[model samples]
Target: MEDTTQLLPILAVHFHNDLGLATANTLAGIYVGVRQVDVTINGIGERAGNASLEEIVMAIKCRGEEVLGGVYTGINTKHIFTTSNMISKIRKSTKNITDGILKNKGTYEFVSAEDVGFIRASEHGIRLGKLSGRHALKIKILELGYNFEEKQLEDLFWRFKSMAGRKKNITDDDLRALILDETIVPQIA
Candidate 1:
């Protein structure tokens, strides 16, 4: 509660998707002197969810590399995705707590039935994909994804880009084919 500047020299911003609070929180933390902060992947909360850890991390990189007077943390940035997955499992809601926190944690029924396949790892939910033409492709290659190296991102950009009048964005069917080609086919083919 005592978010005085001295208390937080670095901000671990838990950016929830409400009222643009995540960026605001990180900015506030930075203003208040926070240098490190807590975060999650897609802002998965017990109900309305929290902030996105990936965003704050990238924002730091953007400012550091471009605007923030040459200051970038040499973090193993590739692990950001894995870290997000882990936290989602850790801070996820139980099968109970349907009513509300404090007021409903004890009174409500189990709304989120894990037995029904509502997994703690929320892969079933609406997710981001490199489907917005090359825009998403570049974001995945340069900023997001599992095995993207910064140097390789440029090459990926060119490789995935459209030629002449073609668009090189990923599609739902394209993703399905990739899944079948890489994951499913490998298992059975």
Candidate 2:
């Protein structure tokens, strides 16, 4: 079908993922000069779903220059993560969310989350434990938009130490509560 449509002025491919081949078929269509592709976020569609917008777009982005003769979409890839999250929330499908991209995007993600308008917070990987240092607490405090004096940070550190004893890990939410309840530092914004 793609071969026959190559000579047409406008070519579009509508694919289904019944065999998990929607993305593959879409790529094949593009290679054959298909100008338009039908895709959905997270591949949500009838039955097995359609070609995923993320997968298709990222494929073109990562391979278009080398393989597709520089063919590329005008999409702002950074918003990809934000858009995916919005769609997932709307559909109540949180199972698809993963932090693999957050740690190191290039490992499993083909695109950067920042390109899609999502800003990863500094507290993402910080795990507060009994061995955590005062410097670590200070960094986390600043990252959370708080500016505290040395004395205040010391007080909070002790409070954190007490809490860490009870809980194996102190989460960001817990840290936020400690800052709010114990410290007089004003939130940056």
Q: Using alpha carbons, what is the TM-score of model 2? A: 0.59
Judged by lDDT against the true structure, how good is candidate 2? 0.80
**lDDT (tens digit, per residue) of candidate 2 on 2-53:** 5865575888999999998999999999998898999999899999999999
Stretches of candidate 1 above 4 Å error?
A: 1-15, 65-73, 81-189
Candidate 1, 40: how far from true, in Å? 1.2
- Candidate 2 — worst ten consecutive residues by lDDT sum? 94-103
RMSD of each: 18.3, 8.8
lDDT of 2 at 149: 90
lDDT measured at residue 59 in model 1 versus the true structure, 0 to 100: 63
